[model samples]
Target: MDSVLARALIEDPTEDGRLPLFLLFLAFLATFLITRTITRLIRAGKGPFRDRVAGGVHIHHAIPGIVLTIAGAFTSVAVDGSSPGAEIAAVLIGIGASLVLDEFALLLRLQDVYWEREGQLSVQVVSLTIAGLGLMAIGIDPLSDHTLSVGHLVIAINLPFHVAGVLMCVAKGKYSTASVGAFIPPVAWIGAIRLARPHSAWAKRHYSSEKRERAADRAHRFDDRYGRWGLNIEDLVAGKPTASPAVSGQEPSDPKGAA
Candidate 1:
Protein backbone atom coordinates (compact mmCIF):
# COMPACT_ATOMS: atom_id res chain seq x y z
CA MET A 1 0.00 0.00 0.00
CA ASP A 2 3.00 2.30 0.54
CA SER A 3 3.97 1.80 -3.07
CA VAL A 4 0.40 2.34 -4.11
CA LEU A 5 0.23 5.54 -2.16
CA ALA A 6 3.50 6.70 -3.65
CA ARG A 7 2.25 5.95 -7.17
CA ALA A 8 -1.04 7.64 -6.37
CA LEU A 9 0.87 10.71 -5.22
CA ILE A 10 2.12 11.24 -8.74
CA GLU A 11 -1.37 10.38 -9.99
CA ASP A 12 -0.25 9.64 -13.51
CA PRO A 13 -3.16 8.10 -15.38
CA THR A 14 -1.85 7.30 -18.84
CA GLU A 15 -0.20 3.90 -18.32
CA ASP A 16 -2.87 2.21 -16.23
CA GLY A 17 -5.98 3.23 -18.14
CA ARG A 18 -6.08 2.08 -21.76
CA LEU A 19 -8.77 4.52 -22.62
CA PRO A 20 -6.84 7.40 -21.15
CA LEU A 21 -3.74 6.17 -22.91
CA PHE A 22 -5.47 6.48 -26.26
CA LEU A 23 -6.87 9.83 -25.29
CA LEU A 24 -3.53 10.96 -24.04
CA PHE A 25 -1.85 9.95 -27.26
CA LEU A 26 -4.54 11.71 -29.23
CA ALA A 27 -4.23 14.85 -27.13
CA PHE A 28 -0.48 14.82 -27.52
CA LEU A 29 -0.80 14.62 -31.28
CA ALA A 30 -3.40 17.36 -31.34
CA THR A 31 -1.30 19.57 -29.11
CA PHE A 32 1.70 19.05 -31.33
CA LEU A 33 -0.21 19.88 -34.49
CA ILE A 34 -1.93 22.86 -32.97
CA THR A 35 1.28 24.20 -31.48
CA ARG A 36 3.08 23.86 -34.79
CA THR A 37 0.32 25.57 -36.72
CA ILE A 38 0.12 28.33 -34.15
CA THR A 39 3.87 28.85 -34.31
CA ARG A 40 3.67 29.34 -38.03
CA LEU A 41 0.81 31.72 -37.65
CA ILE A 42 2.68 33.69 -35.02
CA ARG A 43 5.70 33.91 -37.28
CA ALA A 44 3.42 35.19 -40.00
CA GLY A 45 2.10 37.82 -37.54
CA LYS A 46 -1.39 36.44 -37.84
CA GLY A 47 -1.65 35.39 -34.19
CA PRO A 48 -3.44 37.82 -31.94
CA PHE A 49 -3.12 38.26 -28.17
CA ARG A 50 -6.08 36.03 -27.49
CA ASP A 51 -4.63 33.28 -29.62
CA ARG A 52 -1.23 33.43 -27.98
CA VAL A 53 -2.66 33.40 -24.45
CA ALA A 54 -5.08 30.65 -25.38
CA GLY A 55 -2.30 28.55 -26.82
CA GLY A 56 -0.14 29.12 -23.76
CA VAL A 57 -3.02 28.17 -21.49
CA HIS A 58 -3.72 25.01 -23.44
CA ILE A 59 -0.13 23.81 -23.48
CA HIS A 60 0.51 24.81 -19.90
CA HIS A 61 -2.46 22.80 -18.60
CA ALA A 62 -1.81 19.94 -20.98
CA ILE A 63 1.70 19.36 -19.66
CA PRO A 64 0.46 18.37 -16.19
CA GLY A 65 -2.29 16.22 -17.67
CA ILE A 66 0.26 14.35 -19.72
CA VAL A 67 2.44 13.89 -16.67
CA LEU A 68 -0.39 12.61 -14.50
CA THR A 69 -1.54 10.28 -17.24
CA ILE A 70 1.90 8.72 -17.53
CA ALA A 71 2.12 8.29 -13.77
CA GLY A 72 -1.31 6.66 -13.75
CA ALA A 73 -0.23 4.16 -16.39
CA PHE A 74 2.89 3.26 -14.45
CA THR A 75 0.82 2.90 -11.30
CA SER A 76 -1.50 0.43 -13.00
CA VAL A 77 1.43 -1.80 -13.87
CA ALA A 78 2.65 -1.69 -10.30
CA VAL A 79 -0.68 -2.70 -8.77
CA ASP A 80 -1.31 -6.30 -9.81
CA GLY A 81 -4.98 -6.47 -8.88
CA SER A 82 -6.07 -2.88 -8.36
CA SER A 83 -8.96 -1.58 -10.42
CA PRO A 84 -7.68 0.83 -13.09
CA GLY A 85 -11.06 2.49 -13.01
CA ALA A 86 -10.61 3.76 -9.48
CA GLU A 87 -7.16 5.09 -10.25
CA ILE A 88 -8.33 6.79 -13.40
CA ALA A 89 -11.25 8.26 -11.55
CA ALA A 90 -9.07 9.92 -8.95
CA VAL A 91 -6.62 11.22 -11.56
CA LEU A 92 -9.35 12.54 -13.80
CA ILE A 93 -10.98 14.32 -10.92
CA GLY A 94 -7.74 15.99 -9.86
CA ILE A 95 -6.48 16.72 -13.34
CA GLY A 96 -9.79 18.06 -14.52
CA ALA A 97 -9.98 20.34 -11.52
CA SER A 98 -6.43 21.48 -12.07
CA LEU A 99 -7.01 22.28 -15.73
CA VAL A 100 -10.09 24.33 -14.98
CA LEU A 101 -8.31 26.24 -12.26
CA ASP A 102 -5.26 26.90 -14.39
CA GLU A 103 -7.39 28.14 -17.25
CA PHE A 104 -9.28 30.39 -14.90
CA ALA A 105 -6.07 31.93 -13.64
CA LEU A 106 -4.77 32.43 -17.13
CA LEU A 107 -7.98 34.13 -18.12
CA LEU A 108 -7.56 36.47 -15.20
CA ARG A 109 -4.05 37.30 -16.27
CA LEU A 110 -5.35 37.89 -19.76
CA GLN A 111 -7.86 40.28 -18.28
CA ASP A 112 -4.99 42.29 -16.82
CA VAL A 113 -3.46 42.47 -20.26
CA TYR A 114 -6.74 43.60 -21.73
CA TRP A 115 -7.30 46.26 -19.10
CA GLU A 116 -3.75 47.53 -19.43
CA ARG A 117 -4.04 47.91 -23.16
CA GLU A 118 -7.36 49.66 -22.87
CA GLY A 119 -5.99 52.08 -20.22
CA GLN A 120 -8.65 51.10 -17.72
CA LEU A 121 -7.22 51.32 -14.23
CA SER A 122 -10.19 50.09 -12.25
CA VAL A 123 -10.55 47.08 -14.45
CA GLN A 124 -6.90 46.17 -14.14
CA VAL A 125 -6.93 46.27 -10.37
CA VAL A 126 -10.15 44.33 -10.14
CA SER A 127 -9.12 41.70 -12.61
CA LEU A 128 -5.71 41.11 -11.05
CA THR A 129 -7.22 40.87 -7.57
CA ILE A 130 -9.88 38.43 -8.69
CA ALA A 131 -7.39 36.31 -10.60
CA GLY A 132 -5.09 36.24 -7.60
CA LEU A 133 -7.86 35.18 -5.27
CA GLY A 134 -9.10 32.57 -7.68
CA LEU A 135 -5.64 31.06 -7.93
CA MET A 136 -5.35 31.01 -4.15
CA ALA A 137 -8.69 29.31 -3.83
CA ILE A 138 -7.75 26.70 -6.39
CA GLY A 139 -4.52 25.93 -4.61
CA ILE A 140 -6.19 25.71 -1.23
CA ASP A 141 -9.15 23.67 -2.41
CA PRO A 142 -6.94 20.97 -3.87
CA LEU A 143 -5.13 20.45 -0.60
CA SER A 144 -8.40 19.92 1.18
CA ASP A 145 -8.93 16.69 -0.79
CA HIS A 146 -7.67 13.93 1.50
CA THR A 147 -7.18 11.29 -1.19
CA LEU A 148 -4.73 13.26 -3.30
CA SER A 149 -1.13 12.81 -2.27
CA VAL A 150 0.30 15.84 -4.07
CA GLY A 151 -2.31 18.30 -2.98
CA HIS A 152 0.08 19.80 -0.51
CA LEU A 153 2.73 20.06 -3.20
CA VAL A 154 0.30 21.88 -5.44
CA ILE A 155 -0.47 24.37 -2.70
CA ALA A 156 3.18 24.89 -1.98
CA ILE A 157 4.07 25.39 -5.64
CA ASN A 158 1.38 28.00 -6.14
CA LEU A 159 2.61 30.31 -3.39
CA PRO A 160 5.50 31.46 -5.54
CA PHE A 161 3.35 31.55 -8.63
CA HIS A 162 0.82 33.79 -6.95
CA VAL A 163 3.54 36.07 -5.70
CA ALA A 164 4.98 36.31 -9.19
CA GLY A 165 1.63 37.28 -10.67
CA VAL A 166 1.21 40.01 -8.12
CA LEU A 167 4.70 41.30 -8.75
CA MET A 168 4.10 41.35 -12.47
CA CYS A 169 1.21 43.72 -11.96
CA VAL A 170 3.34 45.91 -9.76
CA ALA A 171 6.15 46.00 -12.31
CA LYS A 172 4.29 46.48 -15.55
CA GLY A 173 2.29 49.65 -15.29
CA LYS A 174 0.79 49.10 -18.70
CA TYR A 175 0.46 45.70 -20.33
CA SER A 176 2.19 45.66 -23.66
CA THR A 177 3.37 42.52 -25.45
CA ALA A 178 6.67 42.52 -23.59
CA SER A 179 4.84 43.21 -20.37
CA VAL A 180 2.66 40.17 -20.90
CA GLY A 181 5.77 38.03 -21.18
CA ALA A 182 6.80 39.20 -17.72
CA PHE A 183 4.10 37.15 -16.02
CA ILE A 184 6.11 33.95 -15.84
CA PRO A 185 7.15 33.88 -12.18
CA PRO A 186 9.47 35.73 -9.85
CA VAL A 187 11.96 36.28 -12.65
CA ALA A 188 9.27 37.54 -14.94
CA TRP A 189 8.07 39.90 -12.24
CA ILE A 190 11.59 41.20 -11.84
CA GLY A 191 11.80 41.85 -15.53
CA ALA A 192 8.43 43.50 -15.46
CA ILE A 193 9.40 45.85 -12.63
CA ARG A 194 12.50 46.80 -14.54
CA LEU A 195 10.41 47.52 -17.62
CA ALA A 196 7.37 49.07 -15.96
CA ARG A 197 8.65 52.61 -15.72
CA PRO A 198 7.89 55.05 -18.51
CA HIS A 199 9.88 54.89 -21.75
CA SER A 200 12.12 57.92 -21.57
CA ALA A 201 13.39 57.47 -25.08
CA TRP A 202 9.91 57.54 -26.59
CA ALA A 203 8.81 60.41 -24.42
CA LYS A 204 11.86 62.51 -25.34
CA ARG A 205 11.40 61.88 -29.02
CA HIS A 206 7.71 62.79 -28.91
CA TYR A 207 8.26 65.89 -26.81
CA SER A 208 10.99 67.18 -29.11
CA SER A 209 8.79 66.72 -32.15
CA GLU A 210 5.88 68.48 -30.52
CA LYS A 211 8.08 71.42 -29.48
CA ARG A 212 9.48 71.76 -32.98
CA GLU A 213 6.03 71.67 -34.51
CA ARG A 214 4.70 74.26 -32.09
CA ALA A 215 7.65 76.55 -32.75
CA ALA A 216 7.13 76.29 -36.49
CA ASP A 217 3.41 77.04 -36.16
CA ARG A 218 4.07 80.05 -33.95
CA ALA A 219 6.62 81.39 -36.44
CA HIS A 220 4.23 80.89 -39.31
CA ARG A 221 1.40 82.78 -37.57
CA PHE A 222 3.74 85.61 -36.55
CA ASP A 223 4.93 85.97 -40.12
CA ASP A 224 1.38 86.00 -41.40
CA ARG A 225 0.37 88.82 -39.02
CA TYR A 226 3.53 90.93 -39.36
CA GLY A 227 4.56 90.47 -42.97
CA ARG A 228 2.44 93.48 -44.14
CA TRP A 229 3.86 95.66 -41.38
CA GLY A 230 7.34 94.68 -42.41
CA LEU A 231 6.58 95.58 -46.06
CA ASN A 232 5.34 99.02 -44.92
CA ILE A 233 8.71 99.63 -43.16
CA GLU A 234 10.50 98.58 -46.33
CA ASP A 235 8.35 101.04 -48.33
CA LEU A 236 9.11 103.86 -45.86
CA VAL A 237 12.82 103.14 -46.10
CA ALA A 238 12.51 103.08 -49.89
CA GLY A 239 10.50 106.37 -50.02
CA LYS A 240 7.33 104.67 -51.34
CA PRO A 241 4.83 104.72 -48.50
CA THR A 242 1.06 104.72 -49.29
CA ALA A 243 -0.28 108.18 -50.08
CA SER A 244 -1.61 110.18 -47.11
CA PRO A 245 -5.21 111.51 -47.19
CA ALA A 246 -5.79 115.25 -48.08
CA VAL A 247 -6.62 117.60 -45.17
CA SER A 248 -10.07 119.28 -45.10
CA GLY A 249 -10.41 122.10 -47.69
CA GLN A 250 -6.90 121.36 -48.93
CA GLU A 251 -5.81 119.42 -52.02
CA PRO A 252 -3.50 116.49 -51.51
CA SER A 253 0.16 117.01 -52.47
CA ASP A 254 1.91 114.46 -54.67
CA PRO A 255 5.62 114.19 -54.14
CA LYS A 256 7.91 114.05 -57.15
CA GLY A 257 8.34 110.55 -58.64
CA ALA A 258 5.44 109.23 -56.44
CA ALA A 259 2.29 107.67 -57.78
Candidate 2:
Protein backbone atom coordinates (compact mmCIF):
# COMPACT_ATOMS: atom_id res chain seq x y z
CA MET A 1 0.00 0.00 0.00
CA ASP A 2 2.77 2.37 0.97
CA SER A 3 4.78 1.62 -2.14
CA VAL A 4 1.81 2.16 -4.44
CA LEU A 5 0.94 5.41 -2.69
CA ALA A 6 4.55 6.54 -2.90
CA ARG A 7 4.65 5.84 -6.62
CA ALA A 8 1.34 7.60 -7.24
CA LEU A 9 2.56 10.65 -5.41
CA ILE A 10 5.91 10.97 -7.20
CA GLU A 11 4.82 10.12 -10.77
CA ASP A 12 1.76 10.54 -12.96
CA PRO A 13 0.86 7.78 -15.44
CA THR A 14 -0.46 10.32 -17.95
CA GLU A 15 1.01 13.77 -18.35
CA ASP A 16 -1.95 15.24 -16.44
CA GLY A 17 -2.82 13.75 -13.03
CA ARG A 18 -6.39 12.66 -13.64
CA LEU A 19 -8.13 10.98 -10.73
CA PRO A 20 -9.69 8.14 -9.49
CA LEU A 21 -6.07 7.90 -8.50
CA PHE A 22 -5.78 4.36 -7.17
CA LEU A 23 -3.82 4.87 -3.97
CA LEU A 24 -5.47 8.08 -2.74
CA PHE A 25 -9.05 7.03 -3.42
CA LEU A 26 -8.87 3.74 -1.55
CA ALA A 27 -8.36 5.46 1.78
CA PHE A 28 -11.57 7.44 1.41
CA LEU A 29 -13.34 4.32 0.23
CA ALA A 30 -12.22 2.66 3.43
CA THR A 31 -13.31 5.60 5.56
CA PHE A 32 -16.79 5.67 4.04
CA LEU A 33 -17.24 1.92 4.29
CA ILE A 34 -16.21 1.85 7.91
CA THR A 35 -18.28 4.90 8.75
CA ARG A 36 -21.30 3.35 7.09
CA THR A 37 -20.85 0.01 8.80
CA ILE A 38 -20.52 1.56 12.21
CA THR A 39 -23.52 3.83 11.72
CA ARG A 40 -25.58 0.83 10.70
CA LEU A 41 -24.57 -1.08 13.80
CA ILE A 42 -25.36 1.88 15.98
CA ARG A 43 -28.78 2.34 14.44
CA ALA A 44 -29.63 -1.34 14.66
CA GLY A 45 -28.81 -1.28 18.37
CA LYS A 46 -26.13 -3.90 18.03
CA GLY A 47 -24.34 -5.29 21.09
CA PRO A 48 -22.35 -3.19 23.54
CA PHE A 49 -19.02 -4.52 22.29
CA ARG A 50 -19.86 -3.55 18.73
CA ASP A 51 -20.86 -0.12 19.92
CA ARG A 52 -17.58 0.31 21.81
CA VAL A 53 -15.56 -0.90 18.88
CA ALA A 54 -17.43 1.43 16.55
CA GLY A 55 -16.55 4.37 18.75
CA GLY A 56 -12.88 3.43 18.60
CA VAL A 57 -13.09 3.04 14.85
CA HIS A 58 -14.64 6.49 14.58
CA ILE A 59 -11.68 8.05 16.39
CA HIS A 60 -9.02 6.21 14.42
CA HIS A 61 -10.25 7.66 11.11
CA ALA A 62 -8.26 10.77 11.80
CA ILE A 63 -5.08 8.83 12.47
CA PRO A 64 -5.01 7.33 8.98
CA GLY A 65 -5.26 10.83 7.55
CA ILE A 66 -2.25 11.90 9.54
CA VAL A 67 -0.37 8.82 8.46
CA LEU A 68 -1.17 9.45 4.80
CA THR A 69 0.22 12.94 5.17
CA ILE A 70 3.39 11.69 6.79
CA ALA A 71 3.73 9.14 4.06
CA GLY A 72 3.43 11.86 1.44
CA ALA A 73 6.15 13.88 3.17
CA PHE A 74 8.52 10.93 3.23
CA THR A 75 7.65 10.00 -0.32
CA SER A 76 8.49 13.49 -1.50
CA VAL A 77 11.89 13.41 0.16
CA ALA A 78 12.67 9.93 -1.13
CA VAL A 79 11.59 10.69 -4.71
CA ASP A 80 13.41 13.95 -4.98
CA GLY A 81 16.52 12.65 -3.18
CA SER A 82 17.22 16.29 -2.31
CA SER A 83 14.88 19.16 -1.51
CA PRO A 84 14.39 21.47 -4.43
CA GLY A 85 13.54 24.93 -3.09
CA ALA A 86 10.18 24.99 -4.89
CA GLU A 87 9.13 21.53 -3.64
CA ILE A 88 10.08 22.40 -0.08
CA ALA A 89 8.14 25.64 -0.20
CA ALA A 90 5.19 23.91 -1.77
CA VAL A 91 5.12 21.30 0.98
CA LEU A 92 5.09 23.91 3.69
CA ILE A 93 2.37 25.92 1.98
CA GLY A 94 0.30 22.82 1.32
CA ILE A 95 0.48 21.77 4.95
CA GLY A 96 -0.53 25.22 6.13
CA ALA A 97 -3.48 25.38 3.76
CA SER A 98 -4.60 21.84 4.42
CA LEU A 99 -4.58 22.27 8.20
CA VAL A 100 -7.19 25.00 8.04
CA LEU A 101 -9.48 22.81 5.97
CA ASP A 102 -8.91 19.84 8.29
CA GLU A 103 -9.89 21.82 11.37
CA PHE A 104 -13.23 22.88 9.91
CA ALA A 105 -13.89 19.36 8.70
CA LEU A 106 -13.52 17.74 12.13
CA LEU A 107 -15.28 20.57 13.92
CA LEU A 108 -18.38 20.30 11.78
CA ARG A 109 -18.36 16.49 11.92
CA LEU A 110 -18.35 16.48 15.73
CA GLN A 111 -21.45 18.66 15.81
CA ASP A 112 -23.33 16.53 13.28
CA VAL A 113 -24.95 14.28 15.88
CA TYR A 114 -25.94 17.20 18.03
CA TRP A 115 -27.53 18.83 15.04
CA GLU A 116 -29.42 15.67 14.16
CA ARG A 117 -30.67 15.13 17.71
CA GLU A 118 -31.89 18.70 17.89
CA GLY A 119 -33.72 18.35 14.55
CA GLN A 120 -31.50 20.95 13.01
CA LEU A 121 -31.24 19.59 9.50
CA SER A 122 -29.30 22.49 8.10
CA VAL A 123 -26.53 22.20 10.64
CA GLN A 124 -26.39 18.46 10.17
CA VAL A 125 -25.99 18.87 6.41
CA VAL A 126 -23.26 21.43 6.79
CA SER A 127 -21.35 19.41 9.32
CA LEU A 128 -21.66 16.18 7.39
CA THR A 129 -20.70 17.77 4.08
CA ILE A 130 -17.60 19.43 5.47
CA ALA A 131 -16.42 16.25 7.06
CA GLY A 132 -17.26 14.30 3.96
CA LEU A 133 -15.27 16.59 1.69
CA GLY A 134 -12.36 16.59 4.08
CA LEU A 135 -12.42 12.83 4.30
CA MET A 136 -12.71 12.57 0.54
CA ALA A 137 -9.83 14.94 -0.07
CA ILE A 138 -7.67 12.98 2.30
CA GLY A 139 -8.37 9.96 0.13
CA ILE A 140 -7.15 11.84 -2.93
CA ASP A 141 -3.38 11.87 -3.24
CA PRO A 142 -2.62 15.53 -3.92
CA LEU A 143 1.15 15.22 -3.76
CA SER A 144 1.25 13.47 -7.12
CA ASP A 145 -0.23 13.85 -10.60
CA HIS A 146 -0.68 17.50 -11.46
CA THR A 147 -3.74 16.83 -13.68
CA LEU A 148 -5.69 15.21 -10.88
CA SER A 149 -4.72 18.12 -8.71
CA VAL A 150 -7.91 19.95 -9.58
CA GLY A 151 -9.95 17.09 -8.21
CA HIS A 152 -8.04 17.48 -4.98
CA LEU A 153 -8.75 21.20 -5.15
CA VAL A 154 -12.42 20.40 -5.44
CA ILE A 155 -12.57 19.69 -1.72
CA ALA A 156 -11.25 23.12 -0.82
CA ILE A 157 -13.36 24.81 -3.43
CA ASN A 158 -16.59 23.38 -2.10
CA LEU A 159 -15.80 24.49 1.43
CA PRO A 160 -17.91 27.60 1.03
CA PHE A 161 -20.99 25.44 0.83
CA HIS A 162 -20.20 24.23 4.33
CA VAL A 163 -19.62 27.75 5.55
CA ALA A 164 -22.98 28.76 4.19
CA GLY A 165 -24.59 25.80 5.86
CA VAL A 166 -23.12 26.79 9.22
CA LEU A 167 -24.42 30.31 8.81
CA MET A 168 -27.86 28.91 8.14
CA CYS A 169 -27.65 26.89 11.37
CA VAL A 170 -26.80 29.97 13.37
CA ALA A 171 -29.67 31.81 11.74
CA LYS A 172 -32.16 29.14 12.78
CA GLY A 173 -31.43 29.87 16.44
CA LYS A 174 -31.68 26.20 17.40
CA TYR A 175 -28.07 25.26 18.09
CA SER A 176 -26.61 25.11 21.57
CA THR A 177 -24.10 27.95 21.56
CA ALA A 178 -21.94 26.36 24.22
CA SER A 179 -21.55 23.26 22.08
CA VAL A 180 -20.35 25.39 19.19
CA GLY A 181 -17.67 26.94 21.37
CA ALA A 182 -16.53 23.55 22.59
CA PHE A 183 -16.16 22.45 18.97
CA ILE A 184 -13.21 24.72 18.37
CA PRO A 185 -10.40 22.51 19.64
CA PRO A 186 -10.50 19.66 17.12
CA VAL A 187 -10.82 22.09 14.28
CA ALA A 188 -7.94 24.11 15.67
CA TRP A 189 -5.88 20.96 15.98
CA ILE A 190 -6.40 20.36 12.28
CA GLY A 191 -4.59 23.62 11.73
CA ALA A 192 -2.15 23.12 14.59
CA ILE A 193 -0.93 19.76 13.40
CA ARG A 194 -0.32 21.12 9.92
CA LEU A 195 1.37 24.34 10.92
CA ALA A 196 3.46 24.83 14.02
CA ARG A 197 2.65 21.12 13.68
CA PRO A 198 2.71 19.25 16.99
CA HIS A 199 0.52 16.18 16.74
CA SER A 200 0.26 14.01 19.88
CA ALA A 201 -0.13 16.02 23.06
CA TRP A 202 -2.19 18.88 21.72
CA ALA A 203 -4.38 16.78 19.46
CA LYS A 204 -5.20 14.30 22.23
CA ARG A 205 -5.93 17.02 24.75
CA HIS A 206 -8.13 19.00 22.41
CA TYR A 207 -10.03 16.00 21.10
CA SER A 208 -10.63 14.66 24.63
CA SER A 209 -11.76 18.00 26.04
CA GLU A 210 -14.15 18.58 23.15
CA LYS A 211 -15.64 15.13 23.51
CA ARG A 212 -16.12 15.43 27.27
CA GLU A 213 -17.64 18.88 27.13
CA ARG A 214 -20.06 17.94 24.36
CA ALA A 215 -21.16 14.81 26.21
CA ALA A 216 -21.75 16.67 29.47
CA ASP A 217 -23.65 19.41 27.72
CA ARG A 218 -25.84 16.90 25.89
CA ALA A 219 -26.74 15.10 29.13
CA HIS A 220 -27.45 18.36 30.89
CA ARG A 221 -29.77 19.48 28.13
CA PHE A 222 -31.55 16.14 27.96
CA ASP A 223 -32.22 16.12 31.70
CA ASP A 224 -33.32 19.72 31.78
CA ARG A 225 -35.84 19.13 29.04
CA TYR A 226 -37.29 15.76 30.10
CA GLY A 227 -36.54 15.03 33.77
CA ARG A 228 -39.81 16.43 35.12
CA TRP A 229 -41.97 14.42 32.70
CA GLY A 230 -41.08 11.10 34.34
CA LEU A 231 -41.60 12.17 37.97
CA ASN A 232 -43.90 10.20 40.34
CA ILE A 233 -44.58 13.09 42.74
CA GLU A 234 -48.31 13.02 42.00
CA ASP A 235 -48.66 9.58 43.62
CA LEU A 236 -46.97 10.77 46.81
CA VAL A 237 -49.15 13.87 47.21
CA ALA A 238 -52.01 13.30 49.72
CA GLY A 239 -54.77 15.35 48.02
CA LYS A 240 -53.40 17.05 44.92
CA PRO A 241 -55.78 17.62 42.03
CA THR A 242 -55.59 14.88 39.38
CA ALA A 243 -57.77 16.52 36.73
CA SER A 244 -57.45 19.10 34.04
CA PRO A 245 -57.41 22.85 34.65
CA ALA A 246 -61.01 23.12 33.39
CA VAL A 247 -62.21 20.42 35.77
CA SER A 248 -60.50 22.06 38.75
CA GLY A 249 -62.01 25.43 37.78
CA GLN A 250 -65.56 23.95 37.89
CA GLU A 251 -65.08 22.18 41.25
CA PRO A 252 -66.70 23.77 44.28
CA SER A 253 -64.41 25.84 46.49
CA ASP A 254 -63.87 25.06 50.17
CA PRO A 255 -66.08 27.11 52.52
CA LYS A 256 -63.07 28.47 54.32
CA GLY A 257 -60.00 29.89 52.55
CA ALA A 258 -58.31 26.44 53.01
CA ALA A 259 -58.54 23.21 51.02
lDDT by residue (tens digit), candidate 1, 220-259: 4544765355334423222232244223343332111100
Give the C-alpha lDDT of model 2.
0.35
Error of 1 at 148 (Å): 6.7
Candidate 2 residue lDDT tens string, 164-194: 4333323322123212312332332232222
Question: Which number leads on lDDT?
Answer: 1
Query: Once superposed on the true structure, which residue ranges of model 2 sit more than 4 Å away at CA?
Result: 1-15, 20-26, 42-60, 63-65, 72-259
What lDDT score is found at residue 235 in candidate 2?
14
Error of 2 at 225 (Å): 26
The alpha-carbon lDDT assigned to residue 22 of candidate 2 equals 29
